[model samples]
Target: MAKAFASQGDMSEKKTSFTEIGEGLYAFTAEGDPNSGVIIGDDSVMIIEAQATPRLAQKVIDCVRSVTDKPISHVVLTHYHAVRVLGASAFGADQIIMSDKARAMVVERGQEDWDSEFQRFPRLFEGHESIPGLTWPTTTFSDSMTVYLGKRKVVIKQIGRAHTAGDSVIWVPDQQTMFTGDIVEYHSACYCGDGHYEDWGATLDAVKAYDPQSIAPGRGDALVGRDMVDAALTNTRDFVDSTYNAVKPVAARGGSLKDAWDAVRDACDPKFRDYAIYEHCLPFNVARAYDEARGIDTPRIWTAQRDLEMWEQLQG
Candidate 1:
């Protein structure tokens, strides 16, 4: 019989693949791990989302080096997750950029999130010690910022709060390709522990408005072609909606967290059971959804101890 439950710590295996998604654009996804995006321009390069550690980011650097010797002058943080931003030092990019809100999140919860995530997923942080403290953004924007990669335009915008309070997406208008950090996920489960469910749907709608021909999501494989792009957006929206709606009524009834978890699992498991990280994210997703349903505007901080306590309450 197949195993029914696995710890988050057990799924940290890394997978590295550099796939060319468009002209001068590539996606480096590590088997369900945090992904990094590469934008090769006329004279320089910009990397979106540094991996968890210097060692991991170095692997991506090696791949980028294979194509061009142009220096990586910019590193863009789509959000301030430890797994994504801690490796900024590895790129040695002169300017590390982020949305204004993302930088604030780092100041507010950077240390807590760092401690929480390192404990939960060890393998992702292959060289945790090499991470020289928390990553700080050198530049930040409120709504949108347009960067020129030696004449190639890459627009970075804070579409809305979906995955985190300060989520941003990088759009390559000429190529009709967008690199959405955690705002959009394909195949892999959406991590909603620090997300805003109501805002997430609106953000997805905004992404759809761009009509991207290709999208490199925060995780899973890159979506190519219009059909595939639409499918990815649709599936992500559906997952978020279904999960939120399933737990809303239970939360409204003032039901136990366990009850809400069961409600969401019953509704989502049939179709999403085989999806990557579905089982692992369900408990946390339901917890957040339940909190949101009760008019909790902000997601409570998730500490390492809180993670285990919540897991036991819902999964036990």
Candidate 2:
């Protein structure tokens, strides 16, 4: 398993696809990797979740070119993860929008996260050198904000902290479509290294409240139709809930971190075993769950070295 971290074992690249979930709304998905959302209004364009680097993001831009010529006016980051925000500079949008909480995280751990994430998944950093620096949001909202793309409307809000300190999603009320950054994963693992598990469940409840017809998730494919959208959200909720459920008892009883990890793996791996990144995310997810279960309300920042140390501890 440690070796699994060292190498992805010749996993080939995935073919990218741009699917229209709503009128003039597109989801740029590349199978198991990170996905991006696109919204084209009469006057401009809005992109959700920038890729790892400018060169990598250019691929999404190229796909965008195939559809619309409207200027990319806004780049909205759902959270402050490095892989999701580093490419903001590439779009050169009029405004880089994000939640105020996410901005605070970027200010605190953006650099460490950049290094940590790049080391964990270097393939995503195709044009690392092209990134000017950490992506700083040009505009930030404390909780929610709405902007008009011509007559089209997009509501961006931080529903609650889930995958990160400030997880947000974009809603197109008229289209009944939502762009969820890392808050929802269909066929992918929910990385809980920086997640808030308890709040995450309530957060998923908040997501369901919107009743999105088509949802563009952070990874995996875009969920189309009510059934698929519900399945995605349910899967997300199950994963988060199960993580907490499996680890809480052990943690509350003062079990070792390894014990909690093993318990979670046993409880969750059987169900989510085949999902993308499941193996890679198990250790980190359990660690965070264990902390939260033991009453650690806030998540600890993970550095590259810290990641390795944690992996070694669990693997050893």
Candidate 3:
């Protein structure tokens, strides 16, 4: 290989911020690392997107303790990605929830993803040894499920497919605050290795339809207020569109994956090169974009070996 992944070289600790978006709703963002959300209901709390390891999860627990001593009763996972769900056991929540599709994806390719991600980004898995195993959801819903943390009404719904086939967003009607898993990112690069390019825009529209007053996005800063929310949405849309559009024509003309990668870099670098994990996500993004443009409806599972093979072919 020519070089290591950008994430592999990123060893410095990210400055984490736990910002309150709604009254009791908070977004725990660590610079551009994977983020976790906290929804403090009337009594117990509900957590969204556990970190990569138990050690990382402890950080979230500490933040939760700072505000309220309420026990974490539920952990809501938006997808089955290892980075998002593997630290679930640390939460000790009675009910760990995911969409039916997400749960199925876990059973199908969870271990492979775990290995692939661990190899790609060592920093995220700070305590890999502590990860018990693949995290499984105790409960799942097909389209949408509503859970009440006392008087708080939290709606978990599969708005559309963008980040992953099983992506779900948590909507708080009272505050109009939404917890969009990787479906919506702020300044950070969207990890589209498992993405749905064609369906992404419509999914963004579904999120827009809610007109969330605040959003605890999958990554980057917590978007509070409408203007900031809209800006992030537009930024994310442009990023996703630019990436797919850049690769679509290359694939259409029977160009190789390398060719598509070059094309995407040409189009996206000037605009998004500064985004978090921009380099780390580029190759995987391009490969998936090329596959999607070539009519692959479902993303192929990524194993540790395939990650290296792809990296060597593109980045190497």
**Which predicted model would earn the best lDDT?**
3
All candidates: CA RMSD (Å): 2.3, 1.4, 0.8
Best by TM-score: 3
lDDT over C-alpha atoms for residue 210 of model 1: 95
Expressed as tens digits, the lDDT of each residue in 1-316 for candidate 3 is: 3788788898899999999999899999998999999999999999999999999999999999999999999999999999999999999999999999999999999999999999889999998899999999999999999999999999999989999999999999989999999998989999999999999999999999999999998989999999999999999999999999999999999999999999999999999999999999998999999999999999999998888888889864
Which residue pairs show backbone clashes in model 3?
A: none
Q: Which segments of model 1 are wrong by more than 4 Å?
A: 1-12
Error of 3 at 63 (Å): 0.5
Q: Model 1 over residues 56-170: C-alpha lDDT tens digits?
A: 8999999999888999999999998899999999999999999999999998899889988887777777888899999999999999999998989999998889999999999
Q: What are the TM-scores, per candidate, against the unseen true structure? A: 0.96, 0.97, 0.99
- Scored against the true structure, residue 121 in model 3 reaches a CA lDDT of 92
lDDT of each: 0.89, 0.89, 0.95
Candidate 1 or 3, higher lDDT?
3
Off by over 4 Å in 3: none
Which lDDT tens digits does candidate 2 get at residues 61-93?
999999999899999999999889998888989
